[model samples]
Target: MNQRLKTIDLARGASVFIMIIVHTLWMFATPDLQGSSLFGTVIHILGKGTASFLVAMGISMALSRRQAPWLLAKRGAQLLLLGYVMNAAKFWLPIEVFNTMPESFINAYGWQSPLNSEQLKFMLLTGDILQLAGVSLVLFAVLNIARWKTHWIATLAVAIALSSEFVRGSQFTLLPYVSDLFFANNYQVYFPVFPWISAILTGYVLGRIYQQKQKDEQYLYKVCAWLGGALLIVGAAWLAVDFKGQFGNFFHLNGGGISYLIGLNLCALALLQYLFANKSSGPITRALLYASKHVTALYVIQWVLICWLMGVFGYHTLTLWPTLYLMVLVSLLTFAVHKLYLQSKRTTIGVMQKTKRTA
Candidate 1:
């Protein structure tokens, strides 16, 4: 019910909405529709949704009161398990829809045909997002052990991000799987320790910032808003430069570059600040705040919906505007379901408390 925390919810709600749209677009539209043009750039920007989610996770961690380590591990494990269950559902579903088969259709990217069940299982085990999330959880557990000073935590996260660059290009690339603690890769794309974990650390810092300043006067809120806006502007300018190919080969993931990620964090912070300072109120903000409060449920459900859509309707060509509309519809439906789930949870908790009092 904290007004400032409403910003986090708003940010989260916006991120979730964007995520659903991006995933829906990925499922329904062709690559040509999302190529590097003006409109394509807008689509490409939507890819930042995952980064924002990860950063938000870190912020939540920072805000969390120190608790039993086992509890944290238990929650992380639960998410890891849920992620795998969703992955399995994605793999098992057939990729045909309504008899409307489009030419040039291919099997789903992660699950190709011709692989035997054993090989398929191996691929599923190794090549899914759950794998990364699982590894991240374990790594986070170890980091939590030190309960290091906040500065130390931030420093370590930065170090990890920097090291990922070297690891990406090295023979030890396979270390991510074995370590399963920090790094992960899929083809040429990488989401190793440094960049991704850095997000979590950044989140932790934001959580601290909120904890310290939630009750401060309006002037402090305004200062935080301006600071966040400045960071966003700096990040956006850097991204423009990157898109122009100004950095050339030096701008690869691990080449000591923070352009895209920094920009995203800044944008997130800016949005958070604006909402805080303005005390924004509307249906959209309310909807987002509700969604943000139940982010884990929303995240799980969205991925499930995306996989179901892709399996049921292979990536056949669709008109852009219609596809966009479909995505919006789906996002709204998904949000409704998430809200219902949250309400049910609250009801159950209340009932349990009442029963305890009676006893």
Candidate 2:
């Protein structure tokens, strides 16, 4: 079996690009532009990057030969710790230590210039995509060790997606940490495990199928295309009938919205596979593949850049022109910073290896 799928890499790279555009809009665009413009509507729909990333992660986990429970556990723990570190760097340090955030921006969010301990705690504990992935991987380690069947996993995903609406936003004050990670529906919990984990589980099931059919590449793409189409039709029809009832909130997608996202991702995957089949060596393709390889690093660098830049931009104050300009600027800076980070890491590893050899 191929160790890595080029299509998956392309999908992730595409998602990263989408994420940059959407995040830039969120951090800088004025309320009217965000809510009332055609561009905003398009960006809102393209916010599938998060779903795509989670699904791709699940697929990767299944494709990987290293299914050792201990390894998964260790990696999951690292991500969990890193999520908090990101929260501190992106939110706490700028607001509290550096005082980089403008008073207007702080007031816009109904927060004081000097955030209190409670607010700081909330920031630190905010459930982001990294936290969701970390928790999911840890849980998957248990599931894998238990030797659960693919169908069982798929059933669990369906159940979670269907029942998410009932338990969403249901918080347990005493168990703030667990609640935020798994159940909370507030702003802090952007990628709660309830419904989002379903996407990962779905990817795992599909990944298993992909493994079986990968040898027959054409057959696999055909199957995915047809299945994706059917799901898209169902999801779109439901949304057309009652969008609010089905979609609810962007972060907290209902069953119908989840179906739509899954279908959309699958279709995109099939299309990408077709496109890259014979042209994988192009400069653009290579660039995307590079971005895919360094997804976590790119995500971290971009968010840190955007969060710090918020002080200069002022939250929700920019017009369409500046917002667009900043999006391009940030994307370039992220790539530059990500390259530097990789170089530093390589140099450190080399120095450590040299020391070990001498010893």
Candidate 3:
């Protein structure tokens, strides 16, 4: 578990690439195109692919040398704060400082160009994947503190998945943000913990097994193949019977959708491990590793870029070809900014370290 897992990183990097494509389609593509096109449909089917991040997180947590409860809880709290900060940067700053929010954007989100207090609050409190990560980590830390068995965790995950539909949109009028993190079914909440947390727990259970069988690559492959395939089959059948029931109209996936996603990720992980575990270093692998290492930073940067650029592009205004071009443009800009941010961070860290040494 101490050893770094390249396949986990690669799996996460692959999802990040998919997210870039998905977000571009979301911000730029016309609604009609998004609904009708093959490309859009495929991207939408891939969906947020955000669950992959949580799965990777669970695996990383299992692999982490430090499993202290306080450390995990502290990291979770930081992510929770960072999520809100990200909301401010991506939504509030564009509306406030840049004055760049298009009327289209305003209309789409039911916000005024001037942005009132209530609107501002809504923007700042929006729930995203980071918030989910933060909550999941804290909850996992609690489970860790209890010294729960993997089977117990797995049973808890199943219970959550089974009960998710029953409480899909339960409201917390007094604490709206709390509602978003757990069960509210609104545009503001992207990753609800009920069904989504199950994905993370599933990953945790698998991660434990994976660590135990790290050297048994064949066993890992079989587990991924058989388990993923079975889940995929069941999920596909359920979806075919009732699409809306299974998927919950995007972002709020039901149990069936969660099953398919977890299955897809497992299969993906198996494939990635097979391809890269024994291979020598290469440009593609190196790039993926970099992306994986900086996944959170990349996610934040890309979202900020997209939200800000909504001023110029307007909401859902681009045609197919133009949207494709913009996706590439946004992607390149995100990477460039991320690279600069990394370099600046490194310089600051080095300077602090040198100052400490001198002191």
lDDT of each residue in 1-359, candidate 2, tens digit only: 14677787888887888888899998899989999999898998888757777778888888887789988888888898988999899988788888897677667657775778887887888788889989998999999899999889989988988887788777787887787688766778888888889889977877887778754656666766886787689879878887886677878777778778877877877898887745768887888888888888788888889989988888888998998999999999999998888899999999999999999
Best by TM-score: 2
For candidate 3, lDDT tens digit of each residue in 1-359?
36567777777877777788799898889998899989889888776566667777787787787789998899899999999999999988888888887778778886567878988888898888898999988987899899999889889987887787789898788976787789867878888998898888877887787778855557766787787787778777878887888785667888888877777777777776777765857887787888888889899999999999898888899998998899889888989999899899999999999999999
TM-score of 3: 0.93
lDDT of 3: 0.82
What would you estimate as the lDDT of candidate 2? 0.83
TM-score of 2: 0.94
Residue runs of model 2 more than 4 Å from their true location after superposition: 172-174
How many pairs of residues collide in each model? Answer: 7, 0, 0
Greater TM-score among 1 and 3 belongs to 3
Q: What's the C-alpha lDDT at position 25 in model 2?
A: 95
lDDT of 1 by residue, 1-359 (tens): 22334555566677877777777776777676766445556865766555566666666666666435666677677766776666565544432223232223334444444446764454345333444455566666777776766677757766765566455434345563444334333432235454566666666665666667764434334543554456456545654655433222222343124435544555655656654625667777777777777766777787666655654455645557767776887797787877688799999999999999999
